[model samples]
Target chain A: MTATATNKQVILKDYVSGFPKESDFDFTTTTVELKVPEGSNSVLVKNLYLSCDPYMRTRMGKPKPSTALAQAYALGQPIYGYGVSRVIESGHPDYKKGDLLWGIVGWEEYSVITPTPDVHFKIQHTHVPLSYYTGLLGMPGMTAYAGFYEICSPKEGETVYVSAASGAVGQLVGQFAKMMGCYVVGSAGSKEKVDLLKTKFGFDDAFNYKEEPDLSAALKRCFPKGVDIYFENVGGKMLDAVLLNMNVHGRIAVCGMISQYNLENQEGVHNLSNIIYKRIRIQGFAVFDFYDKYSKFLEFVLPQIKEGKIKYVEDVADGLEKGPEALVGLFHGKNVGKQVVVIARE
Target chain B: MTATATNKQVILKDYVSGFPKESDFDFTTTTVELKVPEGSNSVLVKNLYLSCDPYMRTRMGKPKPSTALAQAYALGQPIYGYGVSRVIESGHPDYKKGDLLWGIVGWEEYSVITPTPDVHFKIQHTHVPLSYYTGLLGMPGMTAYAGFYEICSPKEGETVYVSAASGAVGQLVGQFAKMMGCYVVGSAGSKEKVDLLKTKFGFDDAFNYKEEPDLSAALKRCFPKGVDIYFENVGGKMLDAVLLNMNVHGRIAVCGMISQYNLENQEGVHNLSNIIYKRIRIQGFAVFDFYDKYSKFLEFVLPQIKEGKIKYVEDVADGLEKGPEALVGLFHGKNVGKQVVVIARE
Candidate 1:
C-alpha cells in the first residue's frame, strides 16, 4: 500500500485564445503513493477512459464573467472532465475500494477525487463497457436526451436536424429522434461521418456540410418541409442558415456551438429575423440541469442499448500521452464518433 | 350611395432597402366611391387615426422568403396598418353602418376593408379614446401583454430589462413588469424618454442607451443582480449587451429588432454562448399567434387602463400627409412615445 508509481498527466500550459494547438498542453509525470490522505473524504481511483468534448475548448480560454455558465478550467493544471475510473481506496463512506464510478476526474492515469456536489456518480451497472461511462452512458448521452426530448419538445414524425451529427452528442440525438419515429437529418463535416449517420445511425438523410457550399440550400435539399427541431451542436454560419430554413413554431435546442469555440471573434448569426415569423424558440441547455433525472434517463436508455435498439460508436486512442491529440482532434472534426482515450483496461 | 370624394392617402412609391426615409412615401389624393362593391362583404370606413410602428419598416422592404412572417406591403399602393375608423358602409353580417372598429385599414382619409383573419378585431369597448384603439387597445398592447405575461413567464421580484423602453410596446411592458412586482429597468434613445420611463411609466430605473458609451456597463448599473427577463425590442448591439448580463435560467422575449430592420446588414450578436450554463432561453413570438387569447388579455388589461394604473403616451401628428414623416421618425427615435397619424378626428 506504500509503494509509489509514476502518475502521468496532460496539463494545460496556459489559458488559450483563438484556435487551440496541441502545444497548449504538456505531458508530465509525477510520483504518487498508493494511499489516500488520512481523514480526507477523497476517493482514489485508477482512470480507465478519458472523454474528449468540444466544451473543453471553452474552459481552456481565460475566464470571463460571462463564462460563469460553467466554471472555467484553471490553467497550469491537469485538465478535468468526464472519465471512467476504478476505485482503489476510499475515505468516503458511500464509496468503498473496488467500486466503480463515472463523473468529473483529472485527465491522468490516477486521480484523487474530493467529491463535490454534482461532480461524480457511483457506477451501479458494469455489464456494459466501462468506457461507456465516458460517453453514451455519460454527459453527452444525457445531453442528447434532455436537449432533444425536453428542450426540443419533439413530436413523432417531425423533422429533426442535428449539426456535427457524427460527434458524440449528435450521433445519439439523431438515433433518439429516429427512435421516436422522427424524420432525422444530420450534417457532419466529412463524408465518412455523413455516411455513418445514414447507414449506422439510420438517419433519414445526412449531408457533409463542408461539401455543401450553401448550407441553406443543402438543408432545403435535405428537408423540403424545413427542420422542426434542431439539435444545434455547431453554431455560427450553420445557425444562420438553419434560422432561414426552420418551419413555423420550430424549436432549436442549442446544445453546443463547436464552430464558434476556437475563434477570438465568433461568427454572427444574421438570419435571426426568421425566429419571429416562424414562432421559433432557441434555447441553450447544459446536461447538468437535467441531472436530477439521471436515473430516469438510465432506466429509459439502458434497455434500448441492451436490446440493440441503439448503437454507439467510439473513436478510441490508447494511452494517457494520446490525450492531447484526442482532445485537439475534436476541434478539427478529426475523429468519427465519440472520442475517448483509453488509459487502462482495469 | 354612389357619391365619390377626394381622399388623402399615403402611398409607398417603391420597396425600401436601408433606413426608411420620408421620400419613400408620397402624399396623394384618390377618389373613394363611398359604397362597398355591390353585394360584397367589404366594409367602407373613414380612417380616423393611423398607427406608426417599427414593424412597418419590415413591410416596406422588398419581399424575401423570411419577410413571409408578415405579408409585405405592395408598392404603388396606399400603405395599410392598424387604424381606428368609423364604418360608413358594411355588407358583412358581423356589422352595419356607423359601427366603430380598430383593425387593419389603409393609411388614408377613407378605406374599404375586407375582414381577414387576425387583421381585425371588433371594438367592443370605446369608452376609452378612439385613438387608444390604434395602440393601447391594439397590436402593441396585445404585443406587450403576450410577450411579457405569456412568453416571459415572469415572477414577482424578478428583474426585467426592456429595450426601446419608451416606445409603444416597451412602455406597456415596463408597466406590466412593475404591476407584477418585478424590478423593471428600461433603456430609451433620448434623455427625455429615459426620464419618462422612470417617472411616468413607473420603471424602477431607466437609461439613455445612446448616451452610454458601453451598453453592457449601463445595464450592469441599472440591474446589478442581472436581468431575469429581457423584453428585446431594439436588437443589434443592445441585444449583444443584454446577453452578457442575463442571469441563470433567464428568459428573453424577443419582441422586435427595430435597430436591424432598416439596415442592409444586420448587426451580429456575440455573447449567445451565455445561454449554456446560464440555461437561458431566447424565444420569438408574434401577437398574432396569441390572438386566441385576446379575450383573456383584454379581461386582464382593460381595468388597469381605465383605473389609471396604466398610463399611455402618444406622439400625435396632424393629418394623413404626416404619415411618412411620422413613420420615418420611428427609425430615428423621433417620436417620444406611440407614433400615430390623425387622418380625420371623427
Candidate 2:
C-alpha cells in the first residue's frame, strides 16, 4: 500500500428529530491509503459529484424499522448517497485508474467501493457534463423513467400532474410525459422553479403550490380534463388535493414524499376516499427496483441530453465543508433543481 | 296490461349529508302494471332479495363529478341496488317468464326493467339457497374473488390481513385466501365477528379491532412476519395501521372505506409514508369491472358452495319496510354477516 492521504468527510452528528439543520452534520477529516486492499476486487475512487437527495432526509431520522426505501445513516458516520467518482486504483479487471462510474459512495473526498454490477454503472458517453450523472443520468433518471412508464403506465395524450416539479425526479418526469404526447402540469414551491418548469422543462402548465391556497382549485384551473397520472414527489396536502382532481382509473406513482419526511407529525391525507370513487391506483416504488433497466434508460436519455431535447438544472455547492448546507437546503426548498456537492472537478 | 299491483318501495327522502339514518328513506306505495310494453325488450319482474351493501352509501349522497363507482341515488326516487328477482314477463330472447335472475333492481316489491347482460346474471345453479345471490354467489362473491386473486395477487403461504372480515366481501376474501394456502388474519368490529373469521370463515387468526387499544400492536402480535396483502374494507385508521405492518412490496386492495363514507369529515390517513418505504401498491376496484368474469367465477365457486367448502351467513330483514334498518345496520356493525332485505321469498 502507498502512503495514506487526508480524506475530508461530512458526518451525521446524530439522528434528526424534526426538520434537519446543517448542524446535524459535522465536517471531519480522516486518512486513507491510496491503494486497493490486497486480494480484494475493490476500486479506490476520488469522489467528483455527490448527490443531495430528498430521500436522505429519511435516512437522517433514527433507525426505527429497516425499509427498502433507504438504510439509515449511522450516527457519527459519513452520510452516503449517489455520486460520480473516478477510479484511482483498480483491483477489478473491468475497471482501471481512469474509468468513471456513478453509484452509491461516501459524502467525502475519497471512497473505496466494492464495484458490484448492481450498485455501479460505468459512465459511458461522458461528453455531457459529468455532473449530469448525479441527477439526470443516475438514480433520478431511472426513477423518472421507471416510475412514469412502468408504474403510471402512461398512455399517449394523457394528462399528467407532477408535484415538486423543480426537483431531481420531477423535472424528468414532466419532460418524459411531454415527449410522449401528454399534457403535463407541474407544481413547485417557488416562482423561479415554477417558471423553470414551464420554460426549461417544457411543462404545458406550471404553478407554485405555495402561492395557491387551494391546490384542488389550482389543479382544476390547469387541468380541465382532470389528471390521468400523478408523479408524486411531495406527499401530504399535495396528494390529498391531487386525489380530488384525479380522473377515473388514474395512476399515482409515489416516488418520494419530501414534504412528509423529517416532520415529527406527517400531514394526514384526507381525500383517500376519492381513490375508491375514482378507481385510482396509488403505487409506491423505488428506483433500485429498476436499476436493471439502467442501460435502457441510458440509451433513451443520453441522446435526448446530447440533442438538447432533454434539459437538466443543478444547484452545486462547493467542497465537503458545504455538504451539510446543500443536503439541509432540500427541506427548505432552497435549491432550484438537483442539489449536488462537488468534492473535486476530476 | 294485466291488473296493477300495489308495490311497496323504499325511496330516498333526500340526499344524505353525514351518517345515513333510517329517516333518510321513506316507505311509500307505487302502482306497477306487471307487463312488458309493446316492442320493448324490458323485463317485468317480481323483486325478491334486495342486497344491503356499504357501497349503497356512496349512492345515497348527492351527485358530484361522475366517477366509475356507484352512481348517486336521486332524491325522492326509489333507491336501487343488487337484488334477486323472478321474471314475470320478458321481451328479450335471453330471458323468459319464470327465469330467476340477479342484478341491479329497485328497492321495491316489483320492478319493470331493461335487463342488459351487464345488469343481470341468470341463476344457473340454484341447488344452494336462493338468498345467497343477495350476498355470496353475487356481487360480494365476485368482489372477493377478483379483489383477492386479481388485485391482491396472492401466493401460497403469504400473510393476508383483511378488515371487516365477517362482512359480505371480507368473509369471502379471508376464505379464498385460506383456500389458496395463505396465513390469513382478519379484523372486525365485535368478538362474534372476529370469532366467525377464525372458526367459521377459516381465517388462521382474528382480532376485534374495537377491543384493541392500539391496532398496530394487535397486527404486530398477529403478523410478526408482516402483512403480504391487506384487503382494505373499512379504511381510515385501520388502513393507517396496516400501512405500518405491510411487508416489502405488499398489495392493498381497496374494497371499501365504510368508516369514512358517511362522516361529515373524513379521517385523514397518517401512515401513508410506509407505502413508499415498503413499495406498496394500493388499488381501488369496483366489482363492475370484473363482471365479464362472472361465468368463470361461478364455475370456480359453485362446487365450493355445494360441497360446503364455502360458507355464507345472512342477516335477512323480512319486508321492504325493514330495508332502511337493514341497510343502515351495516354502518353500526349491527348485522353479524351479509345484511339483506327480503321483499318477497318467491
Number of the top candidate by DockQ? 1
Tens-digit lDDT track of model 1 for A170-265: 999999999888999999988899899989999999999998999999999998988899999988999989998899899999999998999898
Q: What is the DockQ of each candidate?
A: 0.74, 0.71
Residue B78 of model 2 has an lDDT of 94
lDDT of 2 at A201: 95
Residue pairs clashing, model 2: none
Tens-digit lDDT string for candidate 2 (B217-321): 999999998999999998899999999899999999999999998987789898989889999999999888899998999999998988999988888899888
Distance from true location, Cα of A278 in model 1, Å = 2.1
When candidate 1 is compared with the true two-chain complex, its DockQ is: 0.74
Predict model 1's lDDT versus the native.
0.89
Off by over 4 Å in 2: A66-68, B66-68
Best by lDDT: 2
Model 1, B1-346: lDDT tens digits are 5799899888899899998888989978889898898889999998898999988888998888766577788887889999988889999888789898888898888888887768787888877888988888889999999999999999999999999989999999999999999999999989899999989999999988889999999999988889999999988899889988999999999889998998888888787788775888999999888888888888888898889999999999998878899999999999999999998876
The CAPRI class of candidate 1 is: medium
What are the TM-scores, per candidate, against the unseen true structure?
A: 0.97, 0.98
Docking quality tier of candidate 2?
A: medium
